[model samples]
Target: MKKTYLLLTALIVFSYTAIAQAVPAAAKMNQFIDQLMQKMTLDEKIGQLNLLTPGGGIPTGAVVSTDVEAKIKNGQVGGLFGVIGAEKVLQAQRLAVEKSRLHIPLIFGSDVIHGHKTTFPIPLGLACSWDTILIKQTARAAAEEATADGLSWAFSPMVDICRDPRWGRIAEGAGEDPFLGSAIAAAMVRGYQSNNLRQDNTVMACVKHFALYGAAEGGRDYNTVDMSRIRMYNDYLPPYKAAIDAGAGSVMSSFNVIDDIPATGNRWLLTDLLRNQWNFNGFVVSDYTSVNEMEAHGLGNLQQVSALALKAGLDMDMVGEGFLTTLKKSLQEGKITMRDINNACRRVLEAKYKLGLFENPYRNVSTERAATTILSPDKLALSRKAAAKACVLLKNDKTILPLQHTGTIALVGPLADSRRNMLGTWSVSGDWHHAVTLKEGMENVAGQQVKIVYAKGANISDDSLFNKKVNVFGPEIEMGPATSDVMIQEAVAAALQADVVVAALGEAADMSGESSSRADIGLPESPQRLLTALVHTG
Candidate 1:
């Protein structure tokens, strides 16, 4: 009987030890989050939400803050996006792991939409092909390049389904089909999070503009999203839900109000629907300054919006500082519980752990590894291949494109020989200097047989009102002094001289990000006017 008692006691001790760090990966995940949170302070909890700008902000210029270095050492930043390249990420990450109190590793993220070094077709245009395998391949390339850059996350596969082309960010997603969107969403998730989240070559994919930003009123950014529960379930929610089901590592809330409430504060949307209904295990992050914008939406002060967002199941705040500033006061005031804070912190830590940041601290980030993968000769070759593949034969009338190699091709317009504008919106991480512009591309294809003439046919648009909105992001668009007729005559004369007038044109980059949206989706009136003149003169 004494021997039996001794055995039972030993079994109990063994059981408790095993339960503390249980086997099976999912159970171990819970244990790891619990252990990490036990060591964290209230300050560190706030730090998780404070996604401070590492490079660029709304005024459209990048700020290389001297403070970012010190802040990371102090455990003030949870993660970073926008800042690319392996060296930058490694420097920032080292400060976090080597200098912070807890020594928690930082997760590096970027807008690796489509492809990273090898630029694929824009998401919207690519989706038109309806080939899931191609989309997956595009995502795979993005993952490879992103991981090569010391990144473990991508703000990509923006799965929002846009019904209207009028929405500027429509270029960033699949168009208007919930069924197709869901499939592509899963494909993207699989591609980005290949093998596992902890793999060095895999990066977490973020399914973004969540809970119906795409269906914004009149397709305008910052507009309201009003749809019945049934409508959402049947149409809008499927792709995001599909992304969650496919194990997407994170989600980004949109900049729109849902029903009568701002999405940043909607518990039914984020918590009940996303967490409880769909069973999403990953973290939820807000759009840029979206939580702060809730104040403008008449949702009370910053504290009130912050409380609302936290209660609604948002895990991280992006650029708002809403969660960073107000959660502690709310906790003291009996507004939010400790359980709430723990849940949020748990989600964020889970992501970092799954990225293998805690294990090796520099797993995918060797300088040599980054050099071998990023913009390698093969990757550049793939970029040209992707560019060629993405150049859709939109209007191949009389075989306009695949232009005759021997003919003189006139690449007329702002984008003709330009390097910067070849990339569309959100190309900050891309090496625009390397892009072969329309004229350059034409020249390369034609060899010395074709002469390419170029001109800025008209500034993005001649209308001053439209020009103002377009120019808000950058100084790229200049309001030309020439009258509409003068601009047209110039383009017409140039076009009439060449065998084929390749009028290089489109919305300039930065017209489709966040709040930089346009009401009119047509070609800028200046370009339209030029095209008309060119046809009439011929």
Candidate 2:
């Protein structure tokens, strides 16, 4: 194992060496950046500080930027998120590269959290396997598919440490152990970046939710996090540091505040600690509209918060356009210096340079490759194997676990045959139609000898309000017209006819991701009702 780890490290180093040989060295890169900055206007520099989303993935606000193409042409848009497809990405890239004055290539980024096309087990579940190599391989596959789809960056490797199950975003992180979480964080960074940011198969890894986001009081999403600096250093900060140490190219500021100030505008967290103390050289991006949301936190209005965030070492503003629209006025008013804007723009451009975007703006983006790479047979098979290994067996007495493949089995629950929920949360690019249902898997393995019965035991939740919340981003929990009692009866009938009953009951896919927190982190009432009926039927 030690030898394998050493070889992995050596290979990553070689990848980096190969990139250096192809691109300019540090001194030369600096000189090139200096020359580029001299040619850029004030508006163009501030544009590089702005990051926008084009209404494809999760939307945090009502508007989805109708003028994105015009903004790109005017050199007012820096980069884009939530946009996929080689043709669509190529269209957007052309506006920046061909129509804009500087013709600076835009960096396309997305939340390729798990598998981009081939969905793997969730990060929390992947950590349960305790296989760092498997976790790294999953990340590598995600990066490949993302780059094939014309993305140069991934906002992934969420390393927040969370012990509270009530925290919805807990599904995205590697559980509560700082030691294990740090290890996973490093492995994910190494996998995503893979020692070559310029490589087509690799994408710049953004280690996210920086500075105690998981420590939100009461386990509420976007809630305040108050902790002593000692507690922060010892517990919550290690994973972020580990990711940075593993050469992550970007860091995302958490939405929650730290020590009475929001992380986006907190110099102590972003600059004094991350940059000065820990020596993280990567640029920092705000969570979606988090910089603008500071107004509600009583920090200031749009202009005040934008200047505060820029001065606090925030390099990229995601979705808010606070930096794009307000930074120029703030500069004229002397609230921020040209040096600060130049520094932020320089970092953003430097990331693009490292990504080889400056050399070949359309590096590795081919329609044919995009069509063949995503959801390939090999990737799908790996995902199935990963799913089997990640699931922990609670008990298996007398080795009765691996039942003979020739028996009648009943698979019961809302989740048993649901394709949409299979990919889990944050799998934005995963196609649910291709997911293998439990019933299909059972039938395939049984080889027509065993009869597999399936039933929708219950809806994800009986409460209408909860269903609305979970389905905000997508159809996470779909409710049918049948009554709960009818569904329970159907499930019990199936269970009675089978030799063994498998109840697949849990929260819906959206119930555990961002902005989907629950006060009671248990099976919903409908599932509990279904389980009780099944127990009585037996």
Candidate 3:
């Protein structure tokens, strides 16, 4: 017993010695960034403050610049987004590391919001699960796929808390409740960033739409938001605070204004609330061209807003060129201090350093790994399970659920057969061809015992203009050559034949995402008509 005790004491002593001698992660990171920043020129410093998307995913506007490659080589571009595939990312990274004067590495980011290659349930759907661990696992799977594809950052975990269903962006957030939103936010941060940003398989998590974006007036997207400090602190702000507490590596400012000031240039919101009050150490990035849009907000011109954003604690300007073109001019005119520029630059560089970009520019990224990791069987299985769990059974009359393995069933609706819309919104990297439709899933599950009848009962909508708008990213909602009356008849015939009618009906995929808000949010006219016909056929 005495010998055992002595050995345990020795083990404890050794563990203490090891821990005490080791440099703290924070201290080590600070040291590395300090040395790196000391050698950087002012131009390179400002360059790090820019985040550009090189035209691949959903284009918010026309590609404004032509010389992206030249910009990277000249140290005017710090990161690239909307560029996927390992070979493509490698080509871009080579220019940054080999051709640039300082040979600094470039961080690659993407909007892997819900999932990367293996699409999961949408954020709102996932929220219904009320399973934080499951949500975290989804983010981890997304990170694995994204990092394999040569990305180190993901613009995700959009924790905006919105009660209004009319606001389309609510699809991208946890619904309505600040407490639930906060839990999901922390889980996502833990999943993406994983306790260590230096890990190869981990991507930095971004907590987004900071400071009451969800309360846009009249549920309009990118509209003004106004609230008392009491409501802001108690209800709207908790999720963002929770994400920060969970160690999110960055924040993205919302497009709307708070307290009559645009979030991109609001010093009180960005500085006092985020930095001083909450003590968030990570950098803040603008939402797509939000800096330039401040002119429309009646804030100022490009130069004025650019300087305003910088002074307000914005570290990265996304797709605006406001900072790239005007920050220098503002500096010369004494409109903005050199210290503000340096501080923003340092924050940007610090994020890269934390990501261990200096240690290995192409960390966890390779053509071989990229090919092997995405859409993996494990990821798909998780997604399937997540989808199943996310479905909240609101009611089941006469124990109707847990359907028999052997039965005649009718799957009728626009969504039941929709391959493109199954992945839902913001799954930009997901290939719809690979998605399993309800018909496919039903048949695969029930096998030969179950006879499944399927029909596109109706178009997602009768409105051609709305269909065109939704189909901007893809043909998620397309009108067939057949008339809507013919489609409804076909669906009614299928329903009459089946023992059980499973009518899947909902809005088109694009009906609930960025800039897709509806004044009257409901099922489209055609699909609703189809449901009515199916009921009459019964």
Estimated TM-score for each candidate: 0.88, 0.94, 0.95
Q: Which candidate number has the best lDDT? A: 3
**lDDT, model 3, position 481:** 94
Put down candidate 2 lDDT per residue, 1-538, tens digits, no spaces: 9999999999999999989875668777889889999999898899898888778655355547668888999988889987888898888898899999999999999888888988999999999998889899999988889999999899989999987779988999999999999999999999999977888899999989987889988999888788887888889889999999999999999899887889999998899998998888778999888899899999889999999999999999988989988998998899999989988999999999889998998985789998889888888878988898899999986786786787788889998888778888877888888887777777777876788888998998988887898888778788899999988888988999998888988977888888878899988889998988888876
Q: Write the per-residue lDDT of candidate 3 for residues 292-366, one digit (tens) a residue.
A: 989998878999999999999999999888898899999999999989988998888888888999888878568
Candidate lDDT scores, in order, read 0.78, 0.88, 0.88
| Stretches > 4 Å off in candidate 1 | 1-23, 56-71, 394-402, 447-456, 463-475, 478-487
Ranking by TM-score, best first?
3, 2, 1
In angstroms, give how far residue 126 of model 2 lies from its true place: 0.6
lDDT of 1 by residue, 1-538 (tens): 9999999999999998877654577777777877888898987977766676666632332333347777777777788776677787778788888899999888777778768876666777677777777678778777888888888888878989878777877888888999989998999989899867787889998889777989988888767788888888898889998899998989988878788788878998898888898888889988777788889988889998898899998988876677877899999999898888888888888889888888877876867877787777776665556555555565667766567777666667766656666666765467667777777666666777777777667777666675677656454566557776776677777787888787777777766765566777678777787777767766
* Model 3, TM vs. native: 0.95
